[model samples]
Each structure stands twice: as structure tokens, then as C-alpha cells.
Target: MTSPLYGQMMEVPLLASSLLSHASRHFGDIEIVSRRIEGDIHRYTYRDCEKRAKQLAQALIALGVEQGERIGTLAWNGYRHLECYYGVPGMGAVCHTINPRLFPDQIAFIIDHANDSYVFFDMTFWQLVENIAPLCPNVKGWIALGDEGCMAQFRADMSVPVQSYETLIGAQDGDFEWPELDERQAPILCYTSGTTGNPKGALYSHRSTVLHAYAAALPDAMSASSSDAILPVVPMFHVNAWGIPHAAPLAGAKLVLPGKDLDGKSLYDLMEAEGVTFSAGVPTVWLGLLSYMKSEGVRFSTLKRTVIGGSACPPAMLRMFEDEYGVDVIHAWGMTEMSPLGPLARLNHRQKQRPLEDQRRSLEKQGHTLFGVDMKVVGEDGRDLPWDGKSFGNLHVRGHCVIDRYFRREELPLVDGWFPTGDVATIDADGFMQITDRSKDVIKSGGEWISSIDLENIAVSHPQVAEAVCIACAHPKWTERPLIVAVLKPGATVTREELLAHFQGKVAKWWIPDDVVFATELPHTATGKLQKVRLREAYRDYVLPGAVESDA
Candidate 1:
């Protein structure tokens, strides 16, 4: 063993507050715009946001709030919510962003589990706050975010004293300074959507967040810069909106947060009005936007690229965005356990010059790993698989930003040193990775694995099918085979046979779903990913027609 002398250098902790401070000092005049809950456009500058964040920190301190305490927020993507992202953490407290779409019981469970001292929520969730308040008796108080006049009724409903966000921060003079805490202190707490059991928490540190911001703002990531206007269709409450809120401010990009209105027209209007060049969100959000554009015969004047994650981006949607709208669709993959970003699609110069279809195919993959992350796929025997782009296995990753252990859980969630992502994936020789299917969701037909996402994407490519979910069903010969539950477009009709025939040449004949069931709609999670768990349960007993199919 060799003992080495450490290099003498200036040392400074990487703090979340410093990102805001940088913006305040260098890009103080850049606009941070939002469509407020009050149904009006609100505009502010980095200077104004920094001051308000300091005021919020001061107000929390005056309430006897101690460092390391948890503060909960059930708000949408807005300016005040943005303040909480910087403020609570800047004061050495953890900002716990709760997804409001969670059930009232889950909401209560999270608040109680985190031992939240106070909760700040948007007025849009007034009824949710009222219902969960009685259940979370440990919480110190409730505060509603909105105009004071719109909040009087909500204040009367809480058991604890409630105050409007304006009034609470208004009492402070923005005099507090950001505390210098350990770089390892958690600045954010986010829980996974409880699909299987009680949700688990992924606590993010000050250091990981700062590094994630730096990675996300890179040209290959979101391509955020001073010249670009970014509207994060992804909510701030979810994985810190895939790190855009922090990255945008870090790069001096103009931020346009789409509050509660994520419907197609609202997003189009906001994007056009703000001259938004880059936007990001899950595939479902972009689906709504594309549908609206095609229907209204409208086109984006300023938007250039969209980052789609949460689930695989359907090839059909990507084609529509590129062919019709001249917009680039970058597919991304990550999880709550990761600082929520892992691989993102960024083509090198040579890949960019390929034919558009060839380029689109590469972009459809989850993408290449960037700095701060590393990945490998392992088979059931726990052996590393070849990166041949054909064989797939369980995906595992480890890096600076990935979670080592979840909040409050003693069990180590890692296999060896890497975190198992619960996804079955294949990495090509070129270093691009593609998620074939979730480990639980992958369908095994005749003992051969099939990607449900591939099947579903082919199903939705049919003009008549609006949406689809591929699930493994009980079969007669093969233990479990793929079946697609499809939703048809409004006023559009297609036979079950027609939908099945659409996949003829696109995929292997055996990978084709045995049957298709048309329906009115599909189920999705709070953050808009499809709810395969509930759908699987709903079709658990479903039977295949005819005398036992043997196509596989």
C-alpha cells in the first residue's frame, strides 16, 4: 500500500444553492416565465427568483424549522414551486416533492413517513390537502400556493394554521444567506410511484444534484444554453423534472414552466409565446401535443427538439415529429434511483449525417451513457452479456449520481456494486443501449423472450389504433404469449384481424401478438406512464379464442 500526499487546492462544496447564486450573479436578467395557476402569464427574472428563494428560507427559519428537516410540496411546475426547489435545500433542509396524482392514502403515508414539518401545495390540490390533512396529524402546518384571495377557503379547512405562500414569504425581508452544509446532505427527496407496494424514497445529495445539472445541460443532453428557451413539460416534483429546473438556470437558459395545463393547446400556446426551442417530458405528453398539432393544422414556429422518456418513445410518434413537424425526438431512459437520468440519445457527427430513417432508428434506442454513469447487462446466471445488440439481460448501472441505498431502508439495493435497473436491455457495439422491456413486463412466448414495447409500438402505428398496451396472457401451448389491448381513435374503427395484420413485415412473425382487443382508452400512472400492473391484473383470466393457438 502506498500513502500519497494530497494535492493542495482550493476546496468548495458543490451545493444546490450555488447554482442559483451563479444565475443571480451572472444571468440575473434572464426571464423565468410561467403560466400561473391564476390563469395569467407570470414573468420574473433570476434576480427576483433568487430573492424570493432567500425570503422563503428566512420564513422557514423564523418558524423554528431546523436544518435537515423535511418540507413537502404538492405543487405543479410553476415559479413558486421553482423557488422551493432552491430555497428549502439552500437552507440545509430537504425538499420533498410529492406527486399529487398519488392516492390520498399514499400522500398521507409519504408525509408521515418523511416526518414533514410543513407542506406547501398548489391551490389546484385544495381538496387533496383537505382530505389528507386529517390523516397526517404529525405535519406541523399547511400552506397553499396562490393569490391570497383565492386561498381563503382553503385556509379555513386545515386543522393546522395555514397561510398563503405570498403572505408567508411576504413577511420576510430576504435577509437569510445560504448555509454551507456538507456536500453529501440530501437536498431533495422523491418517492417512486407505489405500483407494487408502498413507495420507496430516493434521496439526492447536494453533490449529485450539482453534477447532474452539469451533465443535463451539456449539448448532447438537453442542449440547454443562453440562446435556448426551455419549457419543462415534465413536472418539477418528478425527478426534479429530469434536472431541467436546475440545468436551465445553470446554463442561463430562459425557463418556461407549464403549470397545471399540460394539454396540447396550452403547451403549444406557451411554447410559441415563449419562443421555446427545447422541451422535455414523457412520451405521453408529446403524444398529446402531436395529436393536437395534426388535428388543428398548427405547427410550431420556434420549437426544435423534444426529449421523451419515462417509457420508450414509439417509432410512429418519432416519425410524425420529424417528418411532419421538423422536430427531433430524443429518446431517454432513467429512473428515480438514478439522479433520474442515465442514458440519453446524442448522435455523433457521422451518425447525424446518415439517412433520416437510419438516424431515427438510432434515436429510438435509450442511448449512450454520458459522464457520471456506467452500465452493463447481466443474464439470470449473473454473467455479463455481450453487447451484440441482440442478446439482452437485466440492466445494471453505477456512477456518481445513482442511489447507493434508498432513504430509510437498511437493505442494500445493489447487486455487487451496480444498481439493477429492473429493465431488460441490449447495448450495441456502438455503445447505444435499447430497453427491450421491463423485466416483469417482458413476455416469454414458447420460451423465447419478446419485447412488449416493440409489439405495442407496432400496434399503435396503425392509423386506427390510438393507443395500445402489450401484455403477457395465459396460453395453451406456450406458457405465456403476447396480447395487445388497443384503443381506437375517436370515431375510427378497425377489426381485430386488421390490427394483427398491421405487424406483418415490421417484426418477426412469431413476435406478432396472437390477438388484439379494441377499447376506448388506456390506463396510465400519475406521471403518465402506462399502468401495466393494473392492466395485467384486469386481464389475468382472459382466454385466447379458438382451439389453442400454436403459432409460436
Candidate 2:
């Protein structure tokens, strides 16, 4: 006979609501700062955030938003949006954060796809929601995220039920108790900003989200802590702002949410005013900040560290941050499917001991994976590639937070329990992964693979280039050739020969672009990623110079 087990531990669920409760109890005095849409700074404490969140929860329940129903939010990062993050999930309802920057069709599709019962939007998006409301029949009500008078005119104009966000929560009491919910219950939903197809939803469970927050707070990850003041420049609608919304509270850190005004001057003002220690955003956002700082001869007073992701961080930008600004730039990479927290480019002890140049090179690559995540690269034949840093293959990842299947999709996008990330990458012996290119965007020239990302990074490093992209232009002999499209800084000029000469000794001669094109501004996605697809389409029919074959 088997012996019985000893004492049983508590069976508490890892719901997101618990994070808020812990923050309120342990770090109630911590500040939650925001630059409101009305162009003013709004400040509150964690205790206030928790009380308001509970009141919002009561309001949600009173509005007949049942368990498992979807509550969509079309707003920027701010105190009210943070309340929605907790209140919607705390009440057992799924919080669907709609990206307002997405195309109108995509926004409408996502609203209908999620069957959102109520949409809480800010005054900035009033006209957008007004125009798209008729298309989203499933959306039961519209709540403007403002004071009672802010929405009065809109409410009077609209025939549907339009209410004020502040009034709704103010009418409810904060005495409501959170119900016991399963850890695996879906709490948040985010859609991918995929380049090719329509956006797909990645529904995150309460357990996955909470675990991601913990992993993101680790020293090697985002290194978030109570002593740190975080400024998340990344929009809240983008992958839960890379999980900062939860990770900040989980670590009891002070949060500074930048709403709407993402300009360099505005961000600089907030960082200096709030004494922000850490910030996170895409490369474009940082580029603007760095430019503004340089042109104005401004210096960072309190900003010390930044997390650059959404696209590869250029070596020039990384060096500028580290060498000139004395700030640590953590190069991170992840996807909406993986709950958006994966490898962070922080050096271990051994890596730190390496030569400065070697360490910088490693930092140039995407850093090692977090504790809970597993990564691998596979060839076309389903064989695992060696981690020698030379062999590149399809990148695949799996973990507690990775998605097994997309929401409402019948087919599972997995292979042997791993989700293919649709990226071509190489992993070194140290387990550092470097994304070479997207599988679709890779230029195949004379049966040899040229990484468009590598070329673009190299080209953008040029002193005169503000932005650059490499696309495959059709060729007669090689079937395809790389063409560099560059956007020069204001009043900056460079000849194609000079730009081509810059690639000398940096990369193979064949890898260099045969010709260069200049543009005033390059296109970018809603999340700030370069839109190469449009460039490819625009140059699809252009023939290579001195080509032997002509169009038949």
C-alpha cells in the first residue's frame, strides 16, 4: 500500500486579478502616471487603481457583460486603460484590445470576429468608432473613456447607447468580490499584425498571462522591479504592450503610460518629468527619440535602460544608446503568439566576460531565451539544425505561453508540439538566436539566400540614411536581385555609388544591391515595422539594368 501524501498546499489560481490585488496590498503607494489625451499629466496610486478597477468590474457586471464575454477597448495607454486590463479580466470577461492604428477594415473585422459586447474608446477615436459602429452589429454599447461631459455631445448625436466611462464606474460601489476563476480561463485577446493575411487572434489564458508577467520581470528578461520606474512607449493594444501592463504591477514597479503623444519631445518630457528609469518601444520610436535628443543637444536625466523590439535594433542605434547616452539597450524578440515575451538580449556572466566587441555582437543578435520558453531551428526536411550560428532554418518555439492554436480556427498551427514562427534564424552555441529574415522576404539570388534584414541594417548604418529596406527586384540572369530603397535624413544626400561603396568589405559583393533608390519616406506598418510588401509590389515590374532578356 502506498503512503498518503503529507500536508497539501493552497490551490490558488494564477489569475491576472491576483496581480492587481497583490500590488494594492503590498505597493499601494506606488504611482501610476499617465500623459492624458487632453494634454495633461494624470497621476494616481496603486490603491486608487485597484479601487477604480473594482468599481469598473461592478459596472461591467451591471451592464450584463457575462462570464467569457468579450469587452473590447479602443484606447491608448493610460490609467483608464490599465483599469480595463484588470477589471475586465478580474470579472471573468475577456479583454480584447483593438489596435486603433490598424486599417478600418481590419478593425471592423476584429470587432465582429471577437463579437465584442461593449467597446470602451477614448475621445480621440470617437469619429473612428462612430463610422465603424454600424458595421459591428455584435457590439452592444459604446462607452467613451472620458468624463461625463466629454461624451455628452457624442451621446446626444448618436442614436445608440453611448455612455461615459467615468460616470459608469462612479455609479458603482467598489465592494464587489472577485469570483473564483480557473487558471486556464481566457483573460486577454490580441491579434497579430501579420503582413500577408488577415490578422488572427491569440487568446491568452489567465495562467499564461500571469506566468509571462513573472518571466518578464526576471533579471535576465525585462529586469522590472519595485525600484524601477517604467515608461511603456509601446501601445497597450500591441501584445499587451509586450506584457508590461501586468509585469509592472506584478513587480510593484511604477508605470508611466504615454497616451497618444508619442513624439520625441513629448516622450522626453515625460521621461524627464517622471524620472523614468526604463522604457520599451520599437526601433522607429527610439530613432525618433535619438534624433530629437541629438538635434536638441538633450541628455537623458533619469532614463537608464530601454527595450528595443518589434524589429531588429540597428547596431548604430545600439551603440548610440550605450556609448553616447550611457544607457543599456536590451534587444528583444517575440510574437503575439508567444504571449509576446521571449528572448531578451541580456548577457550572462560568461558573456559579460567576453571581449567588448564580441559582447556587442552578441547583443546585436537577439539574446538568449527566457526560462519557460524553448526554441529550435528546423530545416525543410524537419531535421533540427545545429546551433553553430552559421546554419539558418525555420524558427520554431514552444512554451507554457506559446499558442497551440489560434482563436476560432479549426486547424492547429503547430509541428510536433512547436509553433512555427515563420522566421529564418540561426542559433549560436550560447543559445543566442539571430533572425536573418522572414522566410517570405528573403531574396533568392542565383540560388543563394541573401538576408534582406541584414542588408537593410547595414544600409541604415550609413551616416546619411534615415531608413532603408532591401527588396528582391526581378532579374533576367539571377531570377532576382536585391534593390536597396533608402530614405535619407532631411537635407542629407548620397549617391548610389557612395552607398554601394559603403557595403564594401562589410558584406559579400554579390550580397550588395545592384542599384539604390531614394525616397522621402519609407512606408511602415501600424506597429512601426517597415512595410517591404508594398515596396516589393511597387517595384515588381521594373527590369534590371543591362538585362539580356526583355519582357516577352
* Candidate lDDT values, in order: 0.90, 0.92
Which pairs of residues clash in candidate 2, taking residues 3 or more apart in a chain or in different chains?
none
Cα RMSD for predicted model 2: 1.7
lDDT of 2 by residue, 1-552 (tens): 433775566889999999999999999999999989777889999999999999999999999999999999999999999999999999999999999998988999999999999999988988888789989998889998899766765666666667889999999989978788999999999999857788999999999999999999999999999999999999999999999999999999999999999999999988999999999999999989999999999999888899999999999899999999999999999999999978989998999999999999999998899977899999989999999999999999999999999999999999999999999999999999999999989999999899998999899899999899999998877888999999998888789989999999999998988889898888899899999899999999876665555443
Best by lDDT: 2
- Candidate 2, residue 194: CA error in Å? 3.8
Q: Where is model 2 more than 4 Å wrong at Cα?
A: 1-7, 153-160, 549-552
Alpha-carbon TM-score of each model against the true structure: 0.97, 0.98
Scored by lDDT, model 2 comes in at 0.92
Please give, for residues 119-233, the per-residue lDDT of candidate 1 as tens digits. 9999889888878989998888888887589877666765556778898899999977888999999999999988878889999999999999999988888888999999999
TM-score of 2: 0.98
**Model 1: clashing residue pairs?**
none
